[model samples]
Target chain A: GIQVEQSPPDLILQEGANSTLRCNFSDSVNNLQWFHQNPWGQLINLFYIPSGTKQNGRLSATTVATERYSLLYISSSQTTDSGVYFCAVGEGNSGGSNYKLTFGKGTLLTVNP
Target chain B: DTAVSQTPKYLVTQMGNDKSIKCEQNLGHDTMYWYKQDSKKFLKIMFSYNNKELIINETVPNRFSPKSPDKAHLNLHINSLELGDSAVYFCASSRLRGEAFFGQGTRLTVV
Candidate 1:
C-alpha cells in the first residue's frame, strides 16, 4: 500500500488570493491525480499528473515522481473554490493494472468573499 | 455524455436493513472502485474490480459485497447495516493505469 500525506490540513483564504497544496507519497507511483470535492459532494477531477506539470484554468499541478511528491496551486481563488482538495496515488507494478488508488486525508480549503 | 454515474444520491435506512448502490461508467474503462468517506471525511478504498473481476479488497467488513456484472458496471451491497455504516460512498472508474473519474457520491444515513 502507498502512503500519501497532504500538508496544511486546513486552509482559509480571502477571495482573489493564491495558495499551494502539497502531497507526499512514500513510493513511486504510476498514476497521480488531484481532485476537488465541492460543497455539493462531487469529486471533480482537477489533474492527472503522474509526472511533470499540468495546468487548467486557475489550477495547476506538478508531480515529481522521482521525489515522490506533488503540488497543486490555485490562483485568484473564488468563493466557489471552497471545498476539500485531495491527492491520490497509485503504485506501479509489473501487472500494468494498478486498480487501487491511495488518497490523502485532503486539504480543506475555505475561500471567503 | 460520457461519465461515471451512480444511482440514489442519498439513502436513509434503519439498522439491520439491506441496501445497494449501483454505478456505471461509459468511459470504456476496465476498472471500477468503491470508496467510503467516514464521518471525519477520510476517504478509503473499499473494493476494486478490474474487468468484472475482484482484484483489490481492502479490510472492509464481510457484510459489504461488491459485484461487477460487466466492465462498465459495479454495484455495492451492504447487509445488516449499523449506525457506523452512515457515510458518503463514492463509485469511480479508471483505465488500466489512468486517472479515475468519480461519481457524485451517495450519502447514507442509518437510524
Candidate 2:
C-alpha cells in the first residue's frame, strides 16, 4: 500500500493570500489527483497531475513522480476557498484489480476577509 | 447535468436496520468507486468496480455490500447498520487512468 502524507494539516490566511500545499507519497503512482472538498461536502476535482504541472485559473499543481511528491498552489485565495484539500494517488499499473486511490488526511484551509 | 449522481443526499436510520444508496454516472467511465469519509474527514476507499466487475475491495466489513449492475450504475447496501457505519459516503467514476468525479455525498446517521 502507498502512503500519502499532506503537509500543513491546518492553515489560516487572509483573503488574497497565497499558499502552497504539499503531498508526498511512499511509492510510484499511476494516478494522482488534487481535490477540494467544499463546505457542502462536495469533492471537486482540481487537478489530475500524475506528473508534470498544470494550472487552472488561480489554482495550479505540480507533481514530481520521480520524487514521489506533489505540490498544489492556491494564489489569491478567496473566502470561498476555505475547505479541505485532498491528494489521492493510485499505485502500480492503472487497470489492475488492486488499483484504487488512497487519500491523504488532507489539509484544512481557512481564508477570511 | 450532474456527471455523477447518488440518491438520498441524507439518510437516518436506526441500528439493526438495512439501507441502500444508489449511484449513477453518465461520464462513460470504466471505473466506479465507493469511499467512506469518517467524522474526522478521513476518506477511505471501500470498493471499486471496473466495467461491472469488482476490482478492489478494501478491508471493509462484510455487512457492506456493493453491487454494480452495469457500467453506469453502482449501489451500496448495508445490513444491520451500526453506529460505526455512520459517515458520509461518496460515489465516484473515472476512466482507468483518469481523474475521478465524485457525487455530492450521502450522509448516513445511525441512531
Candidate 3:
C-alpha cells in the first residue's frame, strides 16, 4: 500500500491571499488526484494530474511523478474555497480498474472574507 | 445530471439495526468505490468494484458488505451497525486511472 502525506495540516488566510498545499507519496502511483471537500461536504474534483501541470480557474496543480510529490496552488482565494483539500493516490498493477485510492489526512483551509 | 449519486443523504439508526446505502453512477465508468470519512475527516477506501466484480476489499469489518449489481451501481449494507460505524460514507466512480467523481456523501449516525 502507498502512503500519502499532506503538508500544513491547517491554513488560514484572507480572501485575497495565496497559498500552496503539498502532497508527498511513499511509492510510485499510477493516479494522483486533488479534491476539494467544501463546507457542504461535497467532494469536488480539482485535478487529476498523474504528471505535469494543470490549472483550473484560480486553482492549479502540478505533479512530479518521478519525485512522488504534488503541489496545489490557490491564487486570490475566496471564502468559498474554505474547506478540506485532499490528495489521493492509486498504486497497483491493474492500471485503475481494480486499484484502490489511498487518501491523505487532508489540509484544512479557511479563507476568511 | 449528477455523475454519481447516493440515496438517504443522512441516516440515523439505533444499534443492532441494519441499513443500506445505494449508489449509482451515470458516467458509465467501470470502477466504483465506497469510502468512509471519519469524524476527523480522514478518508479511507473500504471497497472497490470493477465491472460488477469485487476487486479491492480493504481491512473493513465483515459487518460492512458491498454489492454491485451492474457496472453503474454499487450499494453498501451494514448489519448490526455499531457506534463506530457512525461516519460519512462516500460513493465514487472513475475510469481506468482517471479522475474520480464522488457523490455528495451519506452521513450515518449510529446510536
TM-score per candidate, in order? 0.97, 0.98, 0.98
DockQ of each: 0.76, 0.82, 0.79
Each model's fraction of native contacts: 0.79, 0.82, 0.87
Q: Find the 10 residues in a row with the least total lDDT in model 2 chain B.
A: B92-101
lDDT (tens digit, per residue) of candidate 1 on B4-96: 999889999999999999999999999999999998878999988888988888889999999999999999999999999999999999887
Candidate with more favorable, higher lDDT: 2 or 3 = 2
lDDT of 2 by residue, B28-104 (tens): 99999999999999999999998998978888999999999999999999999999999999999988757889999
lDDT tens readout by residue for model 2, A12-109: 99999999999999998988999999999999999999899999999999999999999999999999999999999976464465678899999999
Q: What docking tier does model 1 reach?
A: medium
RMSD of each: 1.1, 0.9, 1.0
Candidates 1 and 3 compared: the better one by lDDT is 3
**Candidate 3: where is the Cα deviation over 4 Å?**
A94-97
Please rank every candidate by lDDT, starting with the best: 2, 3, 1
